[model samples]
Target chain A: MTLTHLNARGEAHMVDVADKQETRREARARGSVHMQAATLALLSEGGLPKGDVLATARIAGIQAAKRTHELIPLCHALALSKVTIEFTLDEAESCVHVEAFCRLNGRTGVEMEALTAVSVACLTLYDMCKAVDKGMTIDGVRLEEKRGGRSGDWSREPMPEPAAATSRDPSAEAEKPAEAEKSAAISPTSGVKIQFLAELRERFETAECVLEWARLPSRDIAGVKLALINQDPKYKALLNQRVLCARNEAMSQNEAAVAPGDEIAFFPPVTGG
Target chain B: MKIVINVQQDAFNTEVEQARLTEGRSDIGAIVSFTGWVRDFNERPDVSALTLEHFPGMTEKALHVIAREAGERWALQGATIIHRVGRLEPGDAIVLVMTASAHRRAAFEACDFIMDYLKTRAPFWKKEHTDSGSYWVSERQSDREAASRWEHS
Candidate 1:
């Protein structure tokens, strides 16, 4: 184990990379922003109110790569040769995947720069969409591969399967109690399915189910919101501001009513663009 | 006016910085200092760590310009800005801004002004590590608003 930034007195200091030989170094990192399907549609269709989400995120990522040293205290400032940020819009999984690559002829590895680019790009995506979907999550940010430096090249083991796709389905992973199955029982008439996504999933664990309100509570967005809060007061504060409610995968305001067979999803403001 | 800017990867000594600003200074009357630390929680709870990055040569240059601007805007005996880069945990000092002046207002305003400019103008990015994953911190609208107050003046 080596702590490069510590001196004889164990005080923190910048490591002197001045004596190290300059070599071509490259690194790749990846992360993703999970969101609602409707939000994904808005991003892909260029309908986000904040303008081009992908374009803005890409620029943010590239800019972050060049400024890595200024953000990380101990990093050596090197002139980066190239930086690239790419986004994969996976509609089926309801997420935007980000990957960044950084290259330079310098004494230090560019892994941190690459990781920073991916991180910023993901954050920019969240910022652009937060007003509409609050619960978007940024996850799995890691250095996928790196080349050059004294230790040589390294790469992460191949994942058994893409985690992004499976992570979107909270119901599959969450332990369901008898109460959840009872709530999931669909009535012959006037019943609707309710699901919570992202941050809401953690808050309303096993709260998702099918319900039949005699009056079809979804008649106004407020009715559904109140009902959910009534079911669990813990959800009241979250619903009041940061969380957004949706009907059948489309953005719905509190005034909008729910219809039978409709799917209701409650989520927080999306932070990923 | 005396200006000092340091960009490093290790932790800094606040007492040393305070002493440096007041050393051999009989003309100074008031000294103001501000230190920022990484918060354990931002937007979400369970933040495990934070990693900071920056542009080396350019970051130092930008900080110098910001310090000079503070000096020009206020009457001061000395000022210091020390920003740490690299991986930091919660409660670790991320930045230090200190100012000394004959009066408290100049030292106070200058210190506040420097931080406002530093947040938006500095070549730095921060990533928060949480239990579930890590995220890059979004530039806050509040930070922009704070920086913009100095635009007209």
Candidate 2:
């Protein structure tokens, strides 16, 4: 793709959209301000020394979205139909998820405006909370989705690390739980469904196995692992690595309680987003 | 109040689902809906498609629990959640959440709450396919953080 803002001589210039058709276009963007969890708590509770953190940030983002053309010199000034800013307080991640939506019936897309809104909102948050948390980081400012442009619509995909994606095969066919018949055969009577995922599935050469509770010497996770290792020496690798365990569907520890009907799953620390 | 949940591989019509929630009703003055779409790019560029994996039984169980939680916390007339599995292309609708109530606040908050819980608590995992290759999506720390905010709410 050629750069629209540069001429044949490579000098920065604005591309005229005089002949382009105006369509209803919308853009969504996201950003975040990472801070200490304690700082996030204070901001949420209105304990910040700076009064009304979110209110100030909200207004700032709206203003920024409207005046985006002024900030970016080459951007065309257009009347925006709508601009909205939203914030999600994530305590576990110690950050605030900021989202912005900008819409207009115009020749150019509103992606820059949406991105500017999110960026300003995150910066505003950091400005308000910096007194209490100096280490706050403004990050992940990017376009999420844009619709109604010549390119049609584009969205940001949810993805994992590129290195991991290229190095491994996570295709669906490879992930089908080892034959359902195999698991069924192992536990004709009372049994626990023992499933493997991701790397474990490839390494163990089985997606899942059902072990009869009565056949096992014990029923806890440790005992089940031992049984699998005894049944096939390859399963012994599970014990040496930092594999995760889930009972039913919830992550569990080795000593977590187990019963005949429980479903047990083993895998590497999840790479799912 | 009525609750409906679907985990499938089929595409859904937003207007059709919204009509179902407010069908034969005048008491519902507000209906809030959120739709999640598969995007073409993410941390890396040139993402062609996405594959979603889920634990068959647990995925349904988790959606039910999340819906029940929303029902318990809100004054609502109806709530419906639909999530799609399998391969999806850019611009495909992946999830739909709708909440209807007599007023806006309840419907809006409940819809937001359900999405927050679903992002972190759902059993589904995403694998992104790019021009370069494909890889399993990793859980986001921000997602876990977003879900945690509702624990005390």
Candidate 3:
């Protein structure tokens, strides 16, 4: 069936929810920002020049939840009853985990408000810390759970362990030490290098695929993936799935431009709560 | 031109929005409205619900820009955009776009133009949930193509 936002003529309109029953709705969302260890230290120590980073982010998130209707064009105006933003410092991972909760007694659910709060909080954190670490990455934004509304209640399933790091293919495991040594031997040079991460790393035993400047004429993500697949056809099926590409440790699209000496990585979609 | 943009987690009353657009405006001869609802399935048939996300400061700015651009291209008397964000079940309303003008053609075209631009330019993202897992919905190539046509037109 076509979406209700679209009329029979395929035009967009707001749905009339005056007849729907009001219910107490609550939702929670989580995301994380990964940064350098030094940057994390600065954050934990409250040494950031921006004063208190988490406090600022928490306020920004709350304000963002209140203004959600302003940001999303089709959202109805809702008076959110409660909005809370919390942060957890994972020192071992050098990451700050953000969680947002939103509540409203309305006809619709509050998941978006919660998700938006988490996203803005993460972005605010990035802005506050960019002076110290410009390489931080924001990822794993998703809805963790929701309650109330016509859908009853829903919760996300626990994510499986990343296949590449955990599931050791016996044959691949036996050869990994030698392959790791080979990868370690190849010093960083003024040439294109491709690395498999997470599950992809386990699938591709070589770990790193270093290419001479002459061989990497087309420095696009698809070209790099194609080159890797050419070296080993076993990656054909894996590459066909929805794999994320990154250039120089930043998330990028498949058509993103690449250059010599760039570090490229391919990994499965990130799943974190 | 009158433009109204709303973003909230509650469902909106289309009748009220439509009445507000045309109320006492004797000059309006035609009103075009569009409503989008959540479908149970996308890419897969098992989707139980959807979670939508948007950029806070940026989404409203983008929607206003699109509404203003539509006003410039068409002689619209009134326009309203209401988008919902949060968890939604099958058959739940997702969005509403309405346009009013002195003539049917202008109202129709303006509404279509706003929607096309909103789909691509808006910062909203959708994530579909199934029994086993949930995944962020990727923008379809067709949506990009649909929005690009406006650039040339």
The most accurate candidate by lDDT is 2
Ranking under TM-score, best-scoring first? 2, 3, 1
iRMS of candidate 3, one decimal? Answer: 13.5
**DockQ for each of the predicted structures, in order?**
0.01, 0.08, 0.01
- Tell me each candidate's i-RMS in Å: 15.2, 6.9, 13.5
Q: How far is candidate 3 from the true structure (C-alpha RMSD, Å)?
A: 26.3
TM-score of candidate 1 relative to the true fold? 0.38
lDDT at A38, model 3: 91
Off by over 4 Å in 3: A1-273
**Candidate 3 local lDDT, B23-97, one digit each (tens):** 877889999999988888887889999877654444576677688778767778888998888788898989999
TM-score: the better of candidates 1 and 2: 2
- Model 3 TM-score on a 0 to 1 scale: 0.39
RMSD of 2: 22.3
> Residue B33 lDDT in model 1?
93
Worst 10 residues of 2 chain B by lDDT: B56-65
